[model samples]
Target: MAMLNPMPYEFLGVRHKPNLNNFFGFIYAKVTVPSSVKVPVLPWKDPETEDTIYPRGFFTGHYFSEELKAVEKLGYKVECYIGYEFSQQSLFNEYVNHFYEAKSKAKERWNFEFLTKEEAANKMFYTYAHEVVELNENHLILVSDTTPSRELLEAQDTDSVFVQNPLPQDIVGSGLGQFKDELK
Candidate 1:
């Protein structure tokens, strides 16, 4: 129930770009600037143009999404910002608070229903993740208070490429890429 809060899953499909979708009706009401989160910037400027290549802002006037700023082998340089508008604050606060609440509740569920985090983690690494994992900077979305976040992507010794996350990586789906063979 809480996972589907703010907006329903199907409803979120509006902004999915036909590949990935999300409910975008929760548009930010205020137009003020955002400044809570800090994003990393490039250390050097464009040699030929004599200008910075990236602007390093997160408020794209749409929903929650980030452009991969840079990659350091296994980690990503990501951008994060908090807007000041009433609508902006409302949405941001809701997302954060709701997520925290969900995590707490889910952890309780895990201990009550299944096993402890240590047991699950140490006992063959059996997946006890309640739902789709959303690795935050230091916590798993609705998993545990002490569940640590990864600092870099651990590629599975294969050539498959995937986006980086400050938290951890949990890709949703691929559209055309999923059906590339069928397209061919």
Candidate 2:
């Protein structure tokens, strides 16, 4: 992952308009997690062209707002990169693998579609999303470890990176609010 010019990187998300039946009929997700949807193809025909089936489209934010808005809806709007960071092809792989692994048990239906060098390179919307997951059991655990081990979380390797949190509830750090306070 080589970042030449060093630009700010933000995770993208997605939003899909569910059919009238909701949950596509029959089933429903018990738990919804923030995610990014990257599908290879759609079974339905493209209404716009009236003949094509969305050839391996990678993103879909054009549906509404960008990825950030989706994340904000998830209540994780504050999550963001604090500085310039580099990127690698694997970054995308690591992302989708999460859902793949979780759904692996359902083998025939949920196994991940291994992406190729070209597919990986052909990254699409590259945005954010809120995934629907069904958790029916009594006990549930969410493992939010993005890194390899707990050590990384304890000693986050922020050597050149700094992740910023959302702004606090009452103080305006800029603009008219600051001007009004200054008047006092």
Best by TM-score: 1
Locate the minimum summed-lDDT window of 10 residues in model 2: 20-29
Clashing residue pairs in all predictions, respectively, total 6, 11
Error of 2 at 122 (Å): 36
- Residue range 21-139, candidate 1, lDDT tens digits: 12223222112222432334323354679765433433223223211212222143222232111111233445656655665677578753343565445344324433566577654
lDDT of 2 by residue, 1-184 (tens): 2222223244332213333121111111112223332322222245577665433322221221222334345442222212122222234445445555554545447654555464344333122223467785542333433443332233322122122433344643322222112111
Residue 162 of model 1 has an lDDT of 29
Query: Candidate 2 — what's its lDDT?
Result: 0.31
lDDT of 2 at 87: 28
User: What lDDT does the true structure give each of the candidates?
Assistant: 0.32, 0.31
As a TM-score, model 1 comes out at 0.19
